[model samples]
Target chain A: MLGAMEVVSPTAPPRGARGLHRFANPGRFLRLAGRALPWVSAIGLVLVALGLVWGLFFAPADWQQGDAVRIMYVHVPAAWLASAGYMALACASAVALVWRHPLADLAAVEIAPVGAGFTAICLVTGSLWGKPMWGAFWVWDARLTSVLVLFFLYLGHIALTRAFDSPERGYRAGAILALVGVVNLPIIKFSVDWWNTLHQPASITLTGAPTMYVGMLWPLLFTALGASFIFAALVLARLSAAVMERRIRALLAARAEGT
Target chain B: MTHLAYIVPAYVSALVIPAWLAGEAWLRLRRARARLLALEGGRRR
Candidate 1:
């Protein structure tokens, strides 16, 4: 399913591999990722800083929420990335299971913990915002509780993917778990509207204009995009490392066999 | 500085978790690259 693109043995001559298969070669991926890393990291970090500065200082405070709404700058983006990152993880899992793409398997492995980190940020920041506005550090609200479930789902995937003796079996199991856990995403999105929850309905929708003021909305958008890029860069870095790790194992095994 | 306790912790986490994650990932990638390069260099020699 992965075509002729193996690990492209370090000792072997470069093949004239073509099409999607060409990029599948781990060596080519490493080269491309190395070239892209600095640019992605610089742009992402810069945008994130600029957007956060605008939100913290220049964006108009909500009359209702006052300065507490400033917490949304980080919280909302973390929430977005947490959910969106899971979607990417599931998609990567699907690609790995169906096509046996080695890179997709590696990507699925890497996306879990970073996605969990974003989820933790979302929860912590939301709690911070809650203390001032809702008078409690936390509540059993639908949105809040559902996101906590999402965080556990990430942890579950991480544990399952490493639970087996065989790497292939572990990856297969993790991919299946990720695909199943994707059912939670839609539930998390609609939980607020489905239940009489304290959490408000989404302020922004694809079909309608954002309910948030323009001054505040722009920074939120900027930071979300910036954070998403950094997410990509992080995953790419991990994937390269994973590929090298697999190769190192192979090399060690081969030396053992030769002796 | 209103609600200094809440807001400070919130931003601190927003900054800290990602930094920790990025640092860990970069260190892993660097270490793996170094090891792989060393092994490849040994094999070629």
Candidate 2:
């Protein structure tokens, strides 16, 4: 069944360049993206709606945080995606730098702004939640500070990628910045434990069972999944735009040369 | 209803930002597609 889908899907990368070439082809990518976009968009919207309704209306509120706890439905997922998006950006940057993959470079460049936006959402929502729970709107604690730095790193990556007239130069500069900025991810993850800050420690741990009850946990997971799918859909849409723009530029260059 | 202010903004920000990003991405895709089509059409002419 999967093979059959692959055969029919325009988005399926051809079995070349060790499979990377299949997706590396912008034309194939655009076609695949076109087919997948609506499904992703629809599923993402439905899941997010269900998650929000379950979280905001049905889930039990925290004994301590009260209704303010509802913020977690949105905040946690945005924070999760913010960090995950950066990791993806770093990986794409590595591929662009090492493999000289044009599509990888474009993906790296396109992902920055989206990641930055997620980081901003995470920060703002964190502040909103913090004000009621922590008794303050903003804090320079380790976790908060590291996430702030992550946001800055994102801004820096965006600026660097657009700085040079030559796209390749911009990609190289941004790739290096992305590679270096990865150090912040671990710090953000461990900051709550490493230092005694106002921010709470991880509720969801890898080894032990989740501290949260199933009612709250299920909604949180749903929201996280919904947000992730939405992020993927956005990335695909942006990547298609970038690929199309690149093609336009190439065609224009060829026309100019001919004239 | 307590802390409704906080809850509302958080969800709003979460939804609005991604929605805006999606809209921007879609617009860019449409513009780029149109430009590519026009450029190719002109070349054929």
Candidate 3:
């Protein structure tokens, strides 16, 4: 099932992508990923473990929400990554569509499932947090609805990428879907301010100081960094596997022809 | 145990979902590498 490929080999550049033609060498990418995977996996997992422990036990509880606020350590990171990862997926899609970068296509494919998982965590944890805070598990507030749309977009990208027998077609279709879904990012970002929603406004912003205390903020930052690294590691591993699987498929094809 | 019911599940889901995905990613990479090795070695022989 994984053996399916396009007329052009996975390693070969697609027609009309001259700008990135020089970096089309798959061997270099495989070698680089191989060297980096071990360090990434080790560091990412350790940081995540440490962050979770610190946030759970050591970090001071909120003066108001108390221990329930501990859920933010997981929820906020998931929410941040959910948005950031989609931005990444969209950028990868743009590269794939514009430059016909095969690696970019593989990257988009790999990022979706992981991105979807993180988004799921965001939604689930948010709902759990809401139960105590808002007296409701689900709501149709702007922030929540927009995030739900983002989740579906991720699912759509995943399904579209695997829907066709030819990987090129799947990649092209998936790329288009990802690019179209890029509009939702800003909506999700400003949803709280755009309307009077149940969701709280952003505590951290690029321009201003965080509204949260240092005691609360540091754990979130640590977990966010840790989870982001883990996310990168997962995507890299998946990309490497996909490339190897393609080579194996090509090799099997050659042997079949020889036989 | 203030909201342990909610907190426990939230923490569990956060850990379990990513861990499951990470495990699957690792398994896929391991399988691909092993199969690729076998195929290349067979070709040489």
Among the numbered candidates, top DockQ falls to 2
Q: Which of candidates 2 and 3 reaches a greater TM-score?
A: 2
> Tens digit of lDDT per residue, candidate 2, span A25-126?
677777788778778877878888999999999999888888898899899988999999999999999999998886999999888889999999999999
Error of 1 at A168 (Å): 1.4
Model 3, chain B only, scores a TM-score of: 0.84
Q: Candidate 2: where is the Cα deviation over 4 Å?
A: A1-16
With a 3 Å backbone cut-off (N, CA, C), the pairs that clash in candidate 1 are none
**DockQ score for candidate 3:** 0.57
User: Candidate 1: deviation at residue B41, Å?
Assistant: 0.7
Arrange candidates by DockQ, highest first: which order?
2, 1, 3
Report DockQ per prediction, comma-separated.
0.58, 0.62, 0.57
Q: Per-residue lDDT for A110-216 in model 1, tens only?
A: 99999999999999999899888988888898888889999999999999999999988989999999999998999899998899888889999988989989999
Q: Under the 3 Å rule for N, CA and C atoms, how many clashes does model 1 have? A: 0
lDDT at A74 for candidate 3?
A: 97
lDDT of 3 at A50: 86
Ranking 1 against 3 by TM-score, winner: 1
Instruction: Look at candidate 3 and tell me the lDDT of residue A96.
Output: 90
lDDT for position A212 in model 2: 90
